[model samples]
Target chain A: MAARGKVYLIGAGPGAQDLITLRGARLLAQADVVLHDALVTDEMLELCPRAEKILVGKRCGQLSTAQQFINKQMIDNALKFPLVVRLKGGDPMLFGRADEELRALEEAGIEVEVVPGITTALAAAAASKQPLTKRGVARSVAFFTSSTAPEHAEHDAIPDTDTLVQYMGGREAIATAERLLAQGRHADTPVVVIENCSRPDQHIRRLTIASLAQGLGAAHGPVLVMLGDAMKTRAHQHNDEAQLPSAVQQLSA
Target chain B: MAARGKVYLIGAGPGAQDLITLRGARLLAQADVVLHDALVTDEMLELCPRAEKILVGKRCGQLSTAQQFINKQMIDNALKFPLVVRLKGGDPMLFGRADEELRALEEAGIEVEVVPGITTALAAAAASKQPLTKRGVARSVAFFTSSTAPEHAEHDAIPDTDTLVQYMGGREAIATAERLLAQGRHADTPVVVIENCSRPDQHIRRLTIASLAQGLGAAHGPVLVMLGDAMKTRAHQHNDEAQLPSAVQQLSA
Candidate 1:
């Protein structure tokens, strides 16, 4: 019997190659066959030059059908390769449909382990020099999404949180804002829209809940919208900041 | 006039040296001085062997006096050193008191920037093969703490969230559970307690809101408690699993 292969579900972090963990980078470098998502960076792929890189990413709107196919391909790869890696955009456990994959791999009698990576909201906070939590101001944070598998997407009530970061929220900002307002979020709640967080081309747009509810123009990069009082400090402070240091300059350069 | 120094507030990540980002590690290596917390690992300090390392951490019960002192020290260091790194335990933006430091640095006309790191909850999820968010099961997640500064610590209401993760929750598990229960969290809500997450000595414990409210034993290491229905799947699945692979053995090795 060929040795039963094990699969590693890895988090690729947000955009930057340097954001990936040393363990994750090491695994990618030595992976027998690596299956990556649509958002995995090319710099990360360069580290895995020796591995067979396969793209199994589901673009927006590609839902359960692609997910089921990815699950099947994962099982097949685990049986053939001693070390198989299924790399996802953020922390595998968060909205990456990892439970389905984990169940499939475990039911097939394959060993599995997950490697965590930095998620995008935190990356957005770092890039903007803001925090998701603050003393006495904003003590808790929520990460949610207005966007879901198209089949399951609906107008769900936005839960109450001190700091709320919504993934894939750009297109639905108007609806999300309406839901939040209906759910009792303050009309003046601070809102920040971050595009391509951590990348050199990242953009930060600040607005109030009312303004965001009115909606804005379309964006090109991956979008995240943060809503809460914790963001108020950043919004107010960014206005007075005039000069960027050499490092930050290079970041936006 | 001598140029003022810049402070880089970098998150060292959840106890693993390798989990620290490439950008974070690079900043550490080049930092003129490094001030790390008690929760920061020694392996992380090794990365900055050439820099002067300062231990300005305040253990549990060490009050706001030390925090004020830390703020003063940070400002003083910025005046002398060209590059000062304030290495925090997790993402500085989350429960890390970064706002006070940012304000102090900015007021003193010194430059500052924050680098994000993987937080403990995400690390715990990765280590336990669980996730902070799921599609139908958990559409939202929250991060909070009961162990605030003594002055700020009170019986505050737990924010309504699908999933909740608490830092320094070991000593306050009973109170936290009671608070959660009072705040409308279900008595049967699943709970997972992770100790010394992402380190070799890490331990994972499972309980329910009711059992957790009854109390658990003290831990020698830092503790994190995760609560949610999203965790229900993992809690059920772990009951029957007994076999450990060689790879897992190496994890304990």
Candidate 2:
């Protein structure tokens, strides 16, 4: 009997190739096949030059391979190869649709190892030099998808937390903001929408939840929305110019 | 005037030293002063031999340095050296309390570069081979801290999500579960608790949210709790007999 192939679901971090974990890099180097997502950078592909690369990406409004089909392809390939790398943007486990693939692989009886990466939520916040959790400002963090199903929206309720980070929210920014408001979230809630995070063209906009829709008109590309009292902290700090150091002012500008 | 020092807020990722991002490792190698958390492993310390390694850790019950004091130390040390690494376990923007330090550095007219790391929330889920999000299973993911100040309990509420990862919730497992239940989360919500994630003695337990507190009794060390419908997908796939090729499983296992 041939050795069954193994699959490594690796997170590629936000965009910077160097942001990838050493373990993820090692796994990519050893992989026989590399199946990557849309958000993965080309530099990440360079890490697995020996591996057969397959672009199994899903872009909004584009005709893409079904996720189930992708998972089956990975499983089938793993059977022939000893190592398969499912490289994803951000952390594979966090909103990366890794579970379906994991189930498909596990059901096929293939062993899977997951190498975690820096998710966009943290990367965006880090890029902006904002702490997702500040002692006096934000005590909790909430994550949701602006790409939610309409039925789920009508039936399910939004959870409340000090801070909220919405994934895949670029197109539905207005609807997401409205739903958040309907959930009793503050109208004046601070919102930071980061688009193409960690990339050279990364763009960030600060707005109130009430004005998020208006702000989205100016935002280009995929977005991750951060909302909470911590947003207020940025404003307060921005107003305290007397305390701000020159360097800090330059960075903010 | 001497060149002002810079601070690199780097996330160390989970316990495995190799899990650290390439940028994080490079920063560590170049650090002049490395102020690390308790959760950082000894293996991670090896990357920064030239630096003055300071342990500024805060355990759940142990006496710890105040965040303000840590900020002061970082500022003071950066003044003496051109490079300081405020090394944190996982991504600095996440529960790592990076905002306070970043604010302090900026306020002092120092340059700060944030290099994100693989957070424990994603690492724990990956280690468990469970997906944090699954198609049709979970559309959103949330990371929360169950560890809270006693006084703030009155106002703090655990929000609902497709999946929830709770950091430092071992001590408050019962209270955390109860809080989630009170928030209308189902009692049978699947929950996976990982202790000392990515470390040698890593332990994982899968239970329902209702039974989580009682199920986890007196377990010591850091704990990460993942709860959601996506977790239930694991149980459904458990009975499937599709086994990976034996050789691959043996090597990976």
Candidate 3:
């Protein structure tokens, strides 16, 4: 049956179009249909000029295309064209809901391949010039999603570690920070909130864990929150004030 | 005084040339001198054909350029070339010793920028079509290094919850598995070990946490081990016998 169409789930990386992997970029360029997320930038879309582009991004309480609908669209498009690109933000495997898409594609007898990209955590860490793991600072690195199911969140407790990165934490940034503090993470632990990371319009604010709950009200767009001693170490080495804009500075003050 | 040259710490992703980000790929092409690790593939190096390629990779117990020597070479190169790319395998901020190199570059009054790439953890997980974080399965994820200071290993303990991804666990794979089991991880916890991930020579095997200690004797080259319920969920969804090669059959047997 037309050799069974193949679907490529590709991570677009953080905002910078060049941050996308060569494989992902090539797939976008060659795909018959490209389904992308809201976080993807125009620069990334330009790489897939020939493909039919469809925006399937979801924002908080927005009239977003449901995940099931996107999966169906991929299957439907693949039937017509052998190549389909399910473009996602950051690394497709990292909190990108790739598993659900994979299962949907597989059930439809569509072949699937995944190409990894730089996740926002790493990109944000890079933009801040912070090593997530250092010799004397952070020995362990933890990743969590602020949008986690309540049951999973309750069962999967945050460990008392020196490095913690929270993904998709824009709306619930304050609540996530508060929960960590309640879980015994030090209040003064250094925290970095990066918005639109790796993009030209990227915003980064360095603050303490205790201040993060209050400071986050000033942030815009999907935020990535990095906490622990590693943040403090990076802040100590770099100029924190230089990175913050006047608006954020006023909020922090 | 001439404007101080800059060093770009770029991640080459996992072995695959196309897997390197477009930005990272561009940087590699423009690099005046490229210092790469042993794990970096020949394909990735081709992007920087005009640049002077230096091998600063660390091999276990083998005579190689010391970190100190490599640091010195970067400083010396910065004096001549306006741009230098310190290419590393996977994400430079993950297990990479970027901090040490950054310190060396900064101390010499050279500017440094880090460009993150897809780490093996994400690459391996993508290859297996498994999400590192799944709803109700894995709420948190942790990346641990088997290559660590003995003092740190002795001082801090690995977390029991969350999905644990271990890097460079080739020789110590069994011991690390044993330690996880000892630390209250379920003996039957699912584990996926990928060797040479994202490369054309990539090899993957699945086993239970209890079986990992015995199964690891056959693991080859810079293995990445992922353990937790998310893996178990993936194992259950796929036909284990059909998906896994017979090479791993002995472990379960």
Task: Give the Cα error of residue A30 in candidate 2, in Å.
Answer: 1.8
Alpha-carbon DockQ of candidate 1? 0.57
Which regions of candidate 1 deviate over 4 angstroms? Answer: A147-155, A234-253, B147-155, B234-253
| Tens-place lDDT digits, model 3, residues A1-253 | 7666778888888877778887788778778889998888898899999999999856544322487788899899888887889899888888887777888877887777777888999998888877888766776798887434555455446655568888877666677767888888878988888888866568888888788777467555668988887776532254433353222222224
Q: Give the per-residue lDDT of model 2 (tens digit) for A1-253.
A: 2688878888898877777888888778878999997889897788998999998867644333577678888988888998998899988887777767777777788877777888888888777667788876776787777434576665656567778888877767787777778878888888887888876677777789889856477555568988887765542233221232222233324
- What digit string (tens of lDDT, one per residue) describes model 2 on residues B1-253? 2677878888898777788888788778878999998889998999999999998866644323567778888899888998899998888888887767777777787777777788888877777767777767776677777445677764576766778888887877888888888888889988888887777667878799878858577765688888888776464344211332232333345
Descending-DockQ candidate ranking? 1, 2, 3
Task: List where candidate 3 sits over 4 angstroms from the true fold.
Answer: A61-65, A147-156, A233-253, B61-65, B151-155, B233-253
List runs of model 2 lying over 4 Å from the truth. A60-65, A154-156, A218-220, A233-253, B60-65, B233-253
In terms of lDDT, the poorest run of 10 residues in model 3 chain A is A244-253
The per-model lDDT (C-alpha) reads 0.80, 0.76, 0.77
lDDT of 2 at B196: 78
Select the stronger candidate by DockQ from 2 and 3. Answer: 2
Q: Is candidate 1 or candidate 2 better by TM-score?
A: 1
| Number of the top-ranking candidate, with lDDT as the measure | 1
Q: What is the TM-score ranking, best to worst?
A: 1, 3, 2
Q: What is the lDDT of residue A82 in candidate 2?
A: 88
